[model samples]
Target: MVLQLHVWGPAFALPSIDAQCLSAIAYCSIALPKDAWELIASSDPSVSPTGELPALQNGSTWVSRFRNIVDYLRQYSDGAWDLDRQLDESDRADNTAFASFVESRGQSLIDLSLYVTSHNYYNNTSPAYGNLLQWPNQWILPPKLHGAAKARTDHLGLSSLDLQAIEEHRQRDHSAAVAAGKIPKNLIQRPRETVSGLLGRGSSKNQFRMEALTADFFEPLEAMLGQKAYLLTLKEEDVPSSLDCIALGSLSLALVPELAFPWLRDAMRAKAPLLSAYTERLRRRCFGDSPVEVAHAYSPQSAPASPLPWRAPGRISIAAVGSTLLAELADSTPFLSEIRRNNRLKQAAADSDLTSVEKGAVSMFADSSKKDMYVSIAAAVGGVAALVGYMFHVGLISVASQEQEFEEEEEEGIPDFGNLSAGDILGL
Candidate 1:
């Protein structure tokens, strides 16, 4: 209850617009509007010691970045509700790499859909933020957001860029992923980056290209899950990992029509349907049904003790009850398609040899090289620092000074916002 997290909210709207805030809440497992921690929404970033949305103020500790906030939780909090608490050393590395993937590629896609696209920006994101404010801000802030996003969109060359250009960008990302080296050798045997794989299932139309690029984000995620109850292997008592927290965080905004573009959601569903269902189970378990809005919440029920007092020889036991329950729920709901999808993804991943941890890399790319330059560089710096600290934590790196150097490097330079509005830039 000592943690007071500041997120974005509305005076007049439905679900929240700020995905970063949603990510923070998921990482912290605050149990939404029901939890003890205070969640406030203010347009002002001055209150943040580091001037970021979703800043944390807990006792004497202060944090403004997602990666740092995660580390703080690992250091200070109990493991009971900690999402990343259950991760093994290898899985911790996997979680870190995949979390980087989500923040870099996944976040770019969300930003484009929400604020840069003409229809979505004017129709959805702007009005949504406008609704969050009082009388003048209600009327005032949205246009500034639109102009800024439009300028950035133009600057990124989203419209003028072509397929060939996108593939080139993919090559660059592929190179970066190879250099990332964050994923360990036991969890992901990184897939071969063939031309077909790079372009994403072969298509010509821009929408096809867009769909393929978006689908790329889900490929590694689906493969990683295989057939587990959650993304990582966990016993009944184990909590989710940072991998799970981040996946939930990214999907929290993308899955909802109120918050994300319908096309983007459809693309994610089509690409990673199994992961979608897995996300549903995680969503229901962690956030509860209607966590963001209103619905009939279904909490998975625990099985009672066996009727017989004594243990019987060769007695039939329950067949994977926890996951089975979730599977049954999927079968009964409209998400039956996802149940069917599990087999397809499983087959594809098996054929590609992707479900293991031997290799590494994800080559998801859009049409412009400049498109991800800003966020990619930003994530790489923080991701490297985190990996170094993690290595020191697990004794993978022996030198204390090396960890200290990286921790100091983690205090990165302030980003240049270019033409973005203060509201748009600070809103994140």
Candidate 2:
């Protein structure tokens, strides 16, 4: 049976929007043959057993996340699919170290460039998600992702890059200035601070910070890749390793895509031209020239006798939508938020050793399933009540008017009992 790799849909000319999914796709592109596996742009995480993307399906079993998928594939083929198998002990150790570094630093940089910065997010990354997802999901997922990115980069202490926050601060200052009967300078300067002017607003400080962030991440990788075509390998013709795939995953998002800010990409090209070149070569080698078409080419009808490996955008089941809507609604309620927090604490206590991403998957399904059920039931009941109330309000469901009821009573009069005695009937 052909293994199926379900990942986030393609965007910005890349195989996947997410770094993890891109890494998984790159790994599969290198390790597996064309006929052995097929790519699916399933985008939705609810289809995954683990509530994560880059889920690998082999017949009835599914493996989630890029690292887990790699492990499973290695074990599946008894090391035949292991890209790191050829490395020495020392090289493997280096691989592990660099992978962690890339995940943390690289991910932070991506978050800053793509999500934390309001300009780039609103203009570029947000639209990218809109292109990838369906109606309700398009509305929901982008902000959720932006929130996640904000949470990840909160410790970076580079709030100056967050233009939205800066604007809010400016608004507060203006309000205070007006209240104190003082005219703020920005009030007069507002017309001059257009998109072009934003770059020059605090150019020195913001540019320095961005450059520092870029250098902190790229300098090490550039040093590692020096004079070699791939990281951890000396030969130009050697196959790219798992480390290469992982690095490419993050670097492609940073370097390949044309963002509104483009600081990271600019810095990468300027400072680390060698690594940039290496990333381009590897991306082409793994995904070929037309990566978008390669990623999204397979359709259900491509293999008539077998099951479809892909789910089209907006093609989710009604049940899935109902559950998602209920979850979103539940998340908005204070009581449910508290309940969710309590569940998270309890789950953390129970599974203290698991990594955050893996813990998220487990807790999402195991701890929150009952909560989701309860929320769904409550939402259904509330919806029914609302519908009935609306009908009553609109006169679709009405009781007789008091005057009409009185008139009907008078017309009917007191009911005469046929079985009553003759004297009683006559008196009545």
Candidate 3:
């Protein structure tokens, strides 16, 4: 059976919106032959065994995340698919270091550009996700992604990029003031500020900060690449290593995508032209220069064939949708919401290497056994049923009883006159 690599659907003229997904795509396209594997834009994380995307399905087993996928591919079929096997020990160490660097710093840069900035997120990133997802999913996935981005870049102290962050801080201060029985500032309301207007105020400062961030990521890669065709090998004939795939994935997102705030792209072109060119050159070589349009809404039918292996998402599993809905509902409930928040805080505080994307998926029943999880679900369902029942009993909600329905059907069959009494009713 052919291996299936499931990922988020294409958006912003890229194979995948996510950096990790793009990394996985590049690796697979290089490692596996054209007929050996197919790409499916599932756009659903629940399809993965690990509840994430860029999942590689080989027979019954599934592998998730770029690093894990790389490891799996390297070992598959007795090392037939290993891209880095040709590397010497020193080059291999460099590969490991560079890959990690790209994943961390590159991810931060992407998040800051696409998601951390309120203007870019609202006008570009969020809409890109919306185009990539179905109805309910489009609503849920963007905020979740945005939150993950915020968490990842929070340590960088670039709150000015997100005007909403300023608003949130204001709200918190107001709440504190209210609790302390103190008057708040600016009781008189002014006109609501546009994000563009606010952004105009700090455009230069934000530009400098964004450039600094992007340079930190791109400069080292440029120096490493130098004049070589790829990252690792110096000869013109050397095949691009796994590190090249990772770097290409990261840089493509940074350089591609015409965002509302095009600071990242501008920075790359100005500060690191060679790296930007390398990203574009590598992407074109792998996926062709033709613009890959977003596929139609997911269907059971296969996606349209192209130079690149873009496939429509498989039929969404009902179970996966249900799981997503349940998770969202749990987050909305007060007690469960608190627990979920605490779990996220704990995960954030823990010294784990999991990325923000990986860390945010806090299980609703993280501490509970399967039985307890089932019981909780059942209780929630039962409570909803009981609440509806109580509403009907108190006349807040009304429904015709079966007997009343039957009586109405009989009456409709034979008309009853107000002037006629019991005899007329009997005749009817």
Candidate 4:
């Protein structure tokens, strides 16, 4: 029986990616019994209990959440999903940790994408403070900032003071978004406008940062996948499964365009086909094709056929697949800390109380923001202490030990030789 997969969401947002990924998996000819795929534009409650997009309906069951859907589809395929390559307990934990990491970082990507689309804010321009002007019809401000003071700033103009006020307003707005479950709580918040403006400026430094981070993410996966056709599994028989494609597709999106990573720039240029496919799909699903045309204006390359197909056979049992499959695809890096720091500085500069000079200084030395100053300083001190201790243990800081010995010599305290037993005094 052809599976009746009802996808509920618009074609141009985060949910769209979910839709596309699922579509690709289905197209790969996975055994989803119901073959018909239905995409509903509106967020129907009957379709989704949470009233969110990308919900799936099969038979009597309605499944929401992207990961849940991925899981559901896998069950219909039985053990073909290969969650974590059938790892033992320890490897499974590692996989879970990695998944959590990916999910958090993925949320940031989603937030940035949503911010870019919703406000027409690009990484190169300032984001529109529309929420401050008028609350989104479906979203309500949190109780903390629902009063008259917030209302005043909501309508504030784009003057210098108003710009500053908008930044401050967004800080609270972000918090509200988190509380309302619009965003993940642990994810860091950066001023969408400022970040977009920086990207717009296209500074060499900013470009370098983008390239470095992108390389850090993708290079490893490329190496892992190697010439083998797949990352985790080697067999062609394993090729068409959703688990295989989703993992690769997600990784390809997260890390690509070696221009973002200078060392791999040449390699990425050579393998442009792999990267372009994901972005083009993203463009098609998010911005209208027009924006994609703008994005690829100078590039002469064409998008490749997606490796995974988008049709399935019967109803997929989502819950049985488990989180292990998703976990193995996550990226683990300390870059998140740096990203968070940059975001915090951006938020600090947007505070109403900060003067223009303060904002400038904070932007220049992003690590020195009031919000992170003490914490950063403490972390630095703790890191130094740890390094010194490591060096001491390794006999590298002999000078310090000598200085300590000298300090002990300068003290008036005498050795308590009388307390030492003969056996202790000996080398026994």
- Candidate 2 lDDT over residue span 199-279, tens digit each: 567777766777788999999999999998889988987777889989999999998887887877988999899999999
TM-scores of all models?
Answer: 0.52, 0.75, 0.73, 0.38
Residue-wise lDDT of candidate 3 within 314-380, one digit each (tens)?
5667777788899899989866776666665554334245566555443323544344655877899
- Total clashes for model 2: 0
Write down the lDDT of every candidate, Cα atoms only: 0.55, 0.79, 0.78, 0.41
Clash count for each candidate, listed in order shown:
8, 0, 0, 28
**Model 2 segments more than 4 A misplaced:** 176-189, 192-201, 291-314, 338-428
C-alpha RMSD of candidate 1: 26.9
Measured with C-alpha atoms, the lDDT of residue 242 in candidate 2 is 89
In candidate 1, how many Å is residue 164 off?
A: 25
Per-residue lDDT for 71-110 in model 4, tens only? 6656755645434445557645644554454444433332
How does candidate 1 score on lDDT?
Answer: 0.55
- In model 2, what lDDT does residue 275 have? 90
Off by over 4 Å in 1: 10-15, 30-36, 59-61, 78-82, 135-157, 160-205, 234-237, 258-261, 291-428
lDDT of 4: 0.41
After superposition, the stretches of candidate 4 with alpha carbons farther than 4 Å from their true spots are 1-3, 8-46, 73-101, 113-212, 240-243, 248-428
Residue 112 lDDT in candidate 4: 28
* Candidate 2 to truth, TM: 0.75
